[model samples]
Target: AENARLRAREAGSLAELEAMVAAFDGCALKRTAKQLAFADGNPEADIMLVGEAPGAEEDRAGRPFVGRAGQLLDRMLASIGLDRSRVYIANVVPWRPPGNRTPTPQEVAICLPFTLRQIELCAPRFLVTLGAPATQTLLGLKEGIKRTRGRWVEYPGLVRPARALPMLHPAYLLRQPIDKRLAWRDLRLLRRALDEEPPR
Candidate 1:
């Protein structure tokens, strides 16, 4: 795994990192997954969204955020006057897990480097981790999404530092429509962040 991480660190761009991930065979989840759902949206966007893993639709389409959750995500972005074209989107685990179950810690560890490399390459000004897994994985927080969502946390160890925000996954909102209001609040926070000038 360290070898993979080193290769990932050496990747010159998101495209190269993605190619590495696609060719990676360390994680068992990749074997069960239909395809690699690397990412979607503009790679140069200032805001990057990261989710846990792909669902059935995403696995089939080979693109992140393309299911019902994706439709809701589109609306969520629209609410903040943003869209896929304006923000880059990827997942902590590029490959889908069996039965859409959460990726185990071991699986996550194996795949973390690739995602980290992707983040380093994109160098987005702000990052939004959708759901507790992504939030914990990227932000290094043990707290649940409900506790961390809407709050700002700085993520270092990348090409550039970025302020990250945790938000409820669109899939969660789909299951709990009542929580869309809370998600809306987080979206507003993201909008404000986007409006602010980047630090010197």
Candidate 2:
């Protein structure tokens, strides 16, 4: 964990961070994963969305959110007048755990510094944490997504604080289409928040 922190601290820019993550070997997931599933979208975007980890398609593509779930996420963003061009997206764990298994606590601990650093560098105004794992990890909430979703919390960013909104993951919504209504409500909330901002 100390090594991971030191390595993450060395990155002064997103490019450097990506390079560091690519070369980092402290986490065992790096050994089994094919490539680093780094972030995608405009770095200067006002909103940043984070998910749990890379899936098979994301791993194969070396980009976060490229599978069916990703497609759904894209549509979800579009629903609120946003897209990859308007927001930044990444995952808590860059590598795909073997067989898409949940990453162990040790693995999350090892990679968390990098994730935090990534957010620091981006410094978005609004942060959307998708699914329970991301919301719990980033926001330090113990409750499940059902209970925590749609509420706004402050993310203690290293650079500037961002208003974080926890929401159901697109994958979960896929499994439970009826729950999409809840997701729609959250989307409307995000849209309202975005609209509330005064013109820059």
Candidate 3:
């Protein structure tokens, strides 16, 4: 009964939600962005991946995860029997921050709710936060992604009850190839979680 209600709330059809988000004008990043790179992928997938903010490539392409870092993410998902086509992907801040610096708290504040609503819209079984900012925002923790990645944590306060698996972002991976191995391990962990069935 509870599960059925949850599905109803997160039912397919992000049209209304997307429309609402498109009209949002709180975040300052929106002022300087080319376009709102809302989200890209299967809306009903079991996994939702969230990044921090759009970079040059994302701003120009109007899509998250399209640059070199995104390429690495594509390859990572493919390595684990998954791809963007089968998962939900988006950023906390849809627009690129000027100079590509970390978003200010106020910027994240306005946009975080948008992404949260997005999670409600996508309704993924699990959330894979893709960087320090993403992880910290979702989990409300001050710990670094290194201290938190690859572990499953229940998020009851979120719109949907879901598990979170924080991981190093692909952008970071490009900066540190040796860290790619760590991301690979997190992917394996995600695969294992996906293979499990909910307890009845």
Candidate 4:
């Protein structure tokens, strides 16, 4: 498994990484998934958003964040004057887990390399991990979303270090609409970060 991850990490380009993930058979989720939801949006964007896994809509469309959650995500991005076109979006687990259930630890472990490599290839200046799985998986943290959201940390896993922020998933906001305020606060913080003038 480590060798596979190493190979993926060494991929020279985003296209190669995508191809590797598509051909990867180490994870079982791929067998049940309709297609590989590799990523969406501009690969060269400065902001990269990582989600937990592909939902039904995402699996069907072979893109991340295309369901009701995706709609909310779009609105959230719009609030900050950004959109999918300005950000790269992918998932920790590119395939959809059965019954829309949370992916098992083993599944995440097997698929981790592809996502890490995707990030390295995209090399975004800002990284946002949506939901707990994505936050923990990419940021290497154990805290839950309630404790981790709205905080800023540096992700060292990428080819170059990046400022990372964790936030509530849009699906969670859909279920608990009141928590949208917290998400709103996080979005504002992100906007401020993006708007900040880079140090000379």
Candidate 5:
């Protein structure tokens, strides 16, 4: 954990951070994973969306959100007049845990510094955490996504704070199609916020 903090703190830019995460072997997930599933989308975007971890397709593609869930996410973003070109996307755990298993707490702990640093470097106006793990991890929220989704919270950014919104993960929504209505409401909230933010 100490090593992660030190390495993450040393990253001067997003490129530097990616390089550091690629080289750092602190997390065991790195060993089993094929490659780093870093971030995708415009780094200069006003909105940044973060998910729990990479899935098989994302891991293989070395990019965040590239599978069925990713396709759904893209559609969700489009529903609000946003897309990959307009927003940044990343995952809490860059590597795909073997068989897509949930990352252990220790793994999340070690990798969190890098995730936090990624957000700091991006410095987006809005931080959207998808699913329970990301919302809980980034926002320090204790409640589940069902309870926290759509509510605005403050993200304690290292550079500057951003308005954080928790939302249901696309994968979860895929399993429970009816819950997409909730996601739609959250999307509307985000669109409203974006419309109100005035051009950067």
Candidate 6:
């Protein structure tokens, strides 16, 4: 909903961007969504994390990863000495897709510009994409989440040494508990990548 494009053009600081995002109402997602669910955690965190979109609870609560999936995410991040307050968290689409369904390409396109502006404003050192939708869209990869998760790929268009590590979505892990182990492995790999280099 934020004027992401204008923010990109004129943003000089994080405070300014947050103020702009708090007032934006461009995307259609804002029409049905209870809240914008703009972002969570430290605005200046070194690590920036992205997820697919808001789910049922997220839609109601107006925050990213704040449901059961979010609880699991917190535990996973704690395993590697990270948490929301220490790392910035957001979503590819700012609003919840209807009925919590996956966002269509048209929806993604509408929101992409704003998200790009957010990244440009935040400028995190490491990038992590949660779940297939986010990884596929962010990396523009045709590969499936199974094939893409845990594989290292460089995120495009950034001023930092950004590495995008795709991991299983917590919602998926809730349904497929067996895959939680796989997600753990992916998290470890993320830890390693984060350790590879400091912010540039």
Off by over 4 Å in 1: 198-200
lDDT of each: 0.91, 0.91, 0.81, 0.90, 0.93, 0.80
Please give, for residues 1-200, the per-residue lDDT of candidate 1 as tens digits.
79778889889988888888888889898899999999999999989999989999999999999999999999999999999999999998889999999999888888888888898888898999999999888898888789999899998956678989999999999999999999999999999888886644
Model 3 per-residue lDDT tens digits across residues 42-99: 8878889999888898899888888888899999999899987789898878889998
C-alpha TM-scores of all predictions: 0.96, 0.97, 0.89, 0.96, 0.98, 0.89
- Superior candidate under lDDT, 2 versus 3: 2
Top candidate when judged by TM-score against the true structure: 5
| Cα shift from native, residue 27, model 4 (Å) | 0.7
Model 2 TM-score is: 0.97
Could you tell me the lDDT of residue 108 within candidate 1? 85
For model 3 the local lDDT of residue 32 reads 92
Q: Please provide, for model 4 over 1-200, each residue's C-alpha lDDT reduced to its tens digit, 9 standing for 90 to 100.
A: 68568789668999888888888888899999999999999999989999888989998999999999999999999999999889999998999999999998888888887778889889998999999999988887788898999999999876668899999999999999999999999999999988893622
Clashing pairs in 4: none
Tens-place lDDT per residue, model 2, 1-200, is 88888889889999999999998889899888889999999998989999988989999999999999999999999988888999999998999999999888788888999998899898888999999888888999889999999988989874667899999999999999999999999999999988998534
Of the candidates numbered 1 and 5, which has the greater lDDT value? 5
TM-score of 4: 0.96
lDDT of candidate model 4 versus the reference = 0.90
Model 3 residue 89 CA deviation in Å: 0.4
Clashes of each: 0, 0, 0, 0, 0, 3
lDDT of 5 by residue, 60-101 (tens): 999999999999999999998888999999999999999999
- Pitting candidate 2 against candidate 3, the one with the higher TM-score is 2
At residue 180, what lDDT does model 4 achieve? 97
